[model samples]
Target chain A: MTTDFRSNVAQALKQDAVQTHFRTVVDRLRAHRQAALAGDAAFEQLRNRCAAIRADAIRRLPQLLEQFESKAQRNGIQVHWAETTLQANRIVLDIMQRHRATFLVKGKSMVSEEMGVNAFLQSHGIDCLETDLGEFIVQLAGEKPAHIIVPAIHKNRREIAHLMHGHFSELPYSEDIETLAQSARHFMRDKFHAASVGLTGVNFMVAETGTLCLVENEGNGRMCSTVPPVHIAVTGIEKVIARLDDLPPLLNLLTRSATGQPITAYVNMINSPRRPDDKDGPDEVHLILLDNGRSRIAGDPELLKTLHCIRCGACINHCPVYRQIGGHAYGTVIPGPIGAILEPQKQGLDAATGELPQASTLCGACAEVCPVRIPIPAIINRLRWESVRKNQQSQNSRPVVPGAGSRRRPLEAAIWKIWAWCCSHPGIYNRLTKLATRLRNRLPAGMGAWTVARKAPKPARSTLHESLRTMDIDHE
Target chain B: MNDARKAILDRLRLSQYPDSTPVKCDDQNDPVDPVLWPDERIDCFINRMRAVRTEVHDASHDSWLDILHGVCQARSLNNLLVSPHTRRGAMIYAAARRFPALKNYSQSIEDWKSELFTAVDAAVTSAYGGIAETGTVILWPDAREPRTLSLVPPIHIVLLEKNRIYNNLAEAMRIQNWAMIGMPSNVILLSGPSKSADIEQTMTYGVHGPKELIVILM
Candidate 1:
């Protein structure tokens, strides 16, 4: 996916300023947090417990994932393994075709976006609908999520009212949120029961009990998984945790981090579909565990910590950079601090995405706010080195610069040649520097691009070596 | 066991690095803690519960019935569907009579679970069962009371009476232990209405579950 980073950042700055839209969401999340505190002290206790459970599960991720697959298989859930996004998309399309589904009702799944599932499904003539309210708004707008937790944060009431008025002919243009929401509510209620297949993103895949944990503020996730005859959950392999005991701590961190609440409005743990003599749930459940560069990341000691992320977006919310640019500018599915590291690795360190790593100010706010403690800044820097290395290798492998002995570009060779001359002749360098310092004030416009955002300090009158020699006169 | 699982587990066990050690709870006959006397513990529990996103009510007032009636009238749920648990509460029956078509069920959770999907217009279950952080419900998965009652219904109205709300999930889990001889087959955590954001990444409520979720906090 191509990310217009500059435009996304500009848009984020614009929409976030509007008090009615983004502020209302921020207020509601705060209200949810306050309610959690008011009603139950145990919310925090369970949150802590869920966190510990997740931490332990991550510690034994590979084993737990294997266990989950086996158990899920026993429960009649067909498990498919995809090493990359291409594979994941293909698998989902095949499943949709097998089911002969025309309209696919989907739940909020970052993994699906990561794999470009919608486009692939659409290309195959399978129409998919995003059921989450925030996701629905962004989908209609034809844009990537601005915020992970609240994807439509950039949209205000007027924009939503306009969208609803345009989409629903029966509804009048109303600025009221409740009235607008009711319109959307009526729009999707039937789509849920009508769709043949349902798609969801797994929050946590428990290995011990072979259960899938899905936490959502709305009941749409439950409907997507249950109402449809066939349910498909696309989750990264890293989602698997070892035991049920490890759920509480992760849930705690996820809730507080995502919404500042003790827990989400609902946490649905499904072991299997409606069994024999059962009245509810999907008839068949299929879980697709996606690798898509995750295993490669998991093998690396430095990058593995990212897998511990629960997609809470706390880091994004707290990040000054993310708040300024929002998620779309990151140009990757997982945005903010996590995106800076994961995107380049998941895609490549090629030119299209090379500017992303450079986008960050190396601010540790993302790391600080991260519940599982992913070192986003460090990983970003490492990716920069990898990108540089790839650039050097390509340059080295190129044919000798046509007429010269050098195999590098003229610009590269010229820069290095100048550096060699300066190092080999320090006295000449000192004289040239002095001359430049004298002419610095007289330099023409566009002399430097680096100094536009900042100013360069004036050079010293004399070289350090010369000053040292002059000071030696006192010693004599 | 598949070769993958065995291989992964073997590598983990052989590793020298320390991993999480599981702790076993010692409640065989009575897993739940009976004594609720510690004021500090209660206070801590209440404070933490408030820290999450639930509203707490002071139960000191004798007019709990008035509170119920007022909340019902406000949410426009005078026509209610209630579980047997609410019948035991003081003046709950009087409040039920106010709604002309109020449907009351004395059936077990299993029967109610099935009936809720097709028959019940708006279903209400007890919230006195669970704890704070997760907002989970402790439903014993037996022949009479199935796990689907809380999830399948379109509009599920959970009744969390004053005394039933525990300080945290630990106390709730402790209660779950005592309710049955051992751990029940299922435990559910409900935080909000059923929703989805699958189509073009737009969130539409009432996707698979109830469209409108109203909590009558009395």
Candidate 2:
């Protein structure tokens, strides 16, 4: 409920156990990614190809989505479109209502988290269960997913064991990782079978072939989509790829970048509902394409690159700010460099989530390791500008991000205006600097928040012109 | 709902870049170099599979059944879910007395959900092909071998034909003409047994799917 970014960061920094967990897991993930890509000579070219593929998909998103809809329908897969999160949730609810399904089982899907499907369904008198081991652990603890890929990365084994024991009282208390996993597996198997509707997120939607590709190490995704009679897939509109062949390189980059695996345990490609002649599979397949501010993001050429993200969480792994404060501190669905750029755009600049862009130190590690090579730092810089711009309208006739000038303040604007004037006028600038230098020691040691974690700046003893004159250097 | 679709499409259409050209990505130019695997394709496949803790057994076309029997005995399996209609499935059925009790996945999931989830100890299915570059097995689940055979059971035993092995996924898809023939309802590229690193980043097997993946590579 707390929307303030600074307080959330401070609160997160105070939790010693959480901070330690973040540092340990992120370091391991970074090392894993490094070792995975160490000997691959063609990694850079592969990144370029993947970037081009995603960029092309975003550029032709409308056409590809239309084509995908037609082809998916041809394959007997029902397609639904939602302009907002509520609409997306309603689509899922409608499907569940049609089947009279009171319980829904879910695979690991960040999109479902974005749609707040669980909370919505439960409020409407339905049971929604998260079946992924990590997600199940987080759900048992009554918490949100901290990390996208590893939902329980913020919790160590002992904490997880405690939570599991509390929920599954029949299972004996044990801190062993494998034992805990088995306990959850035994518990969720019944849920997976009894649930009538299952929902999952699409990793990549191939437009030409009408196929949904999902990559996961655990088979819960397969179970959720295959075991249930009704399967619903939710995804942001940006996940489409132009061709089926584009999947191999993207899949290679995604697994390697996210975890140090040459390939995950399973790469499931679901094309349609079970044919009438088929033995066992989902009887109904529903695809819900949620356009929650994505089209607005696609309106801007530079910001359209945000949609190219594969959600590998590599940027989150490499982010220094995220390593310190962890994911919850950001108070957003996604955290780290990608989230810093993406959430601000998705939620607009005036919203509390607008402060996410400033959370980064502009470290380039994220872009350096991005599988699709999204220039995250550069996008953060653009968002920073967009947040504080004086005019809400952009100069290039492109639509400005919502709440464009909400961060601008009269005092800050006046200070920058004075600084600009001082730099433009030589005589006045020289006089002001000389005057300031003579009284340098009189300046206050504290300069507001700037001096909280840093020393205040003082004018030099002499101007550069004066020093140059004494040293006999040439002057313009 | 149509209004929502129209609104989204209209907003996206406005954002289309003028003079957009079709992106060209040459599949032949893919960077997963074949030189990375200098050894024979089967060797690379076996090595990669073993790296991820997958059990790979070498067998001739005639000896694969013996290997399957040995695997079942070693694990002391009670029952194996299979599609007795496949060629290998037919072979297993013809020599049924030598192996454990077999269960067929011929019934609809709604009718067989309870037994399939509780009673099946392992599953045996025919892999359409294998990828040597990443050591993945391709399963085009159909009317005979349903998608859940490799998924719902604790143990998954695959019968792979040696001749069907390809260098990588792209090669497998291209040579198989997947785009031209169209994709099946479910196509899985399974590399290893089901596992997860979600608990403090610790790797644990059999979280929700097969705990053991035995490949009889012939």
Candidate 3:
């Protein structure tokens, strides 16, 4: 994926419509969030609470998982555990195979994207359909989500109208949003009723009460969870919190920051499969707690904050880099500032992902607007350092020692060493500078892509030491 | 019990460390506006809900049926899906003597979901009440008034009591103690009709759920 990063970014930037779409929508979202926060004095207080909840949950994650599992079991939900994507996919397939599910309806779940659930199910001869309107569009288009919240934000309505027209040839083609959405809704109603199994992603799992909460605008979430007899909710372990009471502020911050709404249209809390006396809802509910490298991250103090992310995509919207290139350029399930640092470890830390850690501009906009206040810039820098360390280790045949090779890092170290030596001794520095000044014209025009938009600096005629020596000793 | 669960939990438990003091978990509910009277809170809720494109109407228990009939008439909707077990649905159902022109369908979604999802024009379900801060109606769905009534139908009419409106979700849930007792399998917080701004960020309502949300504040 990193091999094509440069090309993907260049191609996305070339699309004038994607640029205008992101510019208008991001500007609107930024203003909407600002206006919403300006009216509320408790914004900071609520953010602090949300951060505290995330921190405390991470600290006591094991206990919370145990509590959640016991309570969920008591509530009649079967809990499954998976250590990796393959295991998670296998579990999902086993359930589907047991039920002989021919078709399934799914709510938007990034974890499913991480596990490639749709592709895996299709390989096993089961058709898994995405029910979220944005997800539905992207699925039909055979593309990944362009953005976290708005999956098809990169594609204009005309493209979607064309896509829909292609899918249902009998339906009249109209670029009108009403027609597109109406067609989708009418088409989805049949899938919702016919699918015997339902799959969904969870927003928050409350350990105290044993409930999985889902927030969305369209009622697809409700339909997928309620319409099927067998419902499966797969989520990362980091999503669990201590109690249900911790949700209000997080909910406030999440909705306001994500789409700049007071609340999303629907927040569904499912405590269990339908009780025996219940007239609606699934007969059996399966909750899959997926580890998939998250538990390893939980141990590291610096990387643990990645788990704090609520998947709100606030940082992505505010990111200038993301606005320019869009999410597809990131080439991962998640994108934007979060993806820059996260994709490496989530996908696999190889030469392919080494460039991803360098994707960010180290701007602090992501941290400022982050609902959970995850320090994204610091994480990116750490990932960059880790990538450098990995590169160094791969080059050497000798066994690596911790913190032993910083002074021997080759090119970067040699440059820094020369720099430190020059700063200390003025004699050689002045002589070297004079030589550099004489040979300034022979210097290269610019280095790589940096020269594209701006001119390179030319060497100065004299060093600071020479200038100071030539000046009067006492101007006063 | 899976070995993966034990293995992951073991690793996590060993690696767990909290540098900053942990945030204590407590029930400190936010009061959006405590000084306001109950009636004022209801007014606040209506304004916020209306801001989000939800239609609100003030009504008494006895007058709600007429208001509902007018809503049905306005949309030219003849068939309504209602649950006989729910209070609001039963109250409106009991008012069949006065409004025989409106048809009310009372059947479990689990049994007749396919027919209801297609044939029903609107669904009127009872609310567990509303949150004034966010302008959301809370529905603790049981056997009657299942989630489908609010989710599938094009029109979702909610019956929220004026006195039942609370400050926010925290206050409402704490007061109700839903996690401890009287916990329903599902709790739904519907702020407005189903909407999507996914296509070029243009807001469009009623994509999958009800397109119109009408609230009768009794």
Which candidate wins on TM-score?
2
TM-score ranking from best to worst?
2, 3, 1
**lDDT tens digits by residue: candidate 2, A256-350:** 89988889999999999989888777999999999999999999888888999999999999898999899988888988899888888989889
Model 3 CA lDDT for position A269: 93
Error of 3 at A45 (Å): 1.9
lDDT of 3 by residue, B1-218 (tens): 38999999998987876565666645364334354678778888999999879999999977878888888878887677776666666676677654434334444455686677778788888899899988999998876666677788788888888888998888888888876785788899999999898887888888988899999988
Per-residue lDDT over A22-59 for candidate 3, one digit per residue giving the tens place of the 0 to 100 score: 77877887888888888676677677778888988988
Candidate 3 local accuracy as lDDT?
A: 0.83
Candidate 2 residues lying further than 4 Å off, grouped into runs, are A1-3, A392-399, B19-24, B27-32, B35-39
Regions more than 4 Å wrong, model 3:
A390-409, A420-442, A465-476, B18-35, B100-110
DockQ of each candidate relative to the true complex: 0.20, 0.83, 0.69
- Per-candidate clashes come to 76, 0, 0
Q: Which has the better lDDT: candidate 1, or candidate 3?
A: 3
Candidate 3 chain A weakest lDDT stretch, 10 residues: A398-407
lDDT of 1 by residue, A182-214 (tens): 667667766864777999999988787678888
Displacement of the residue B48 alpha carbon in candidate 1, Å: 8.5
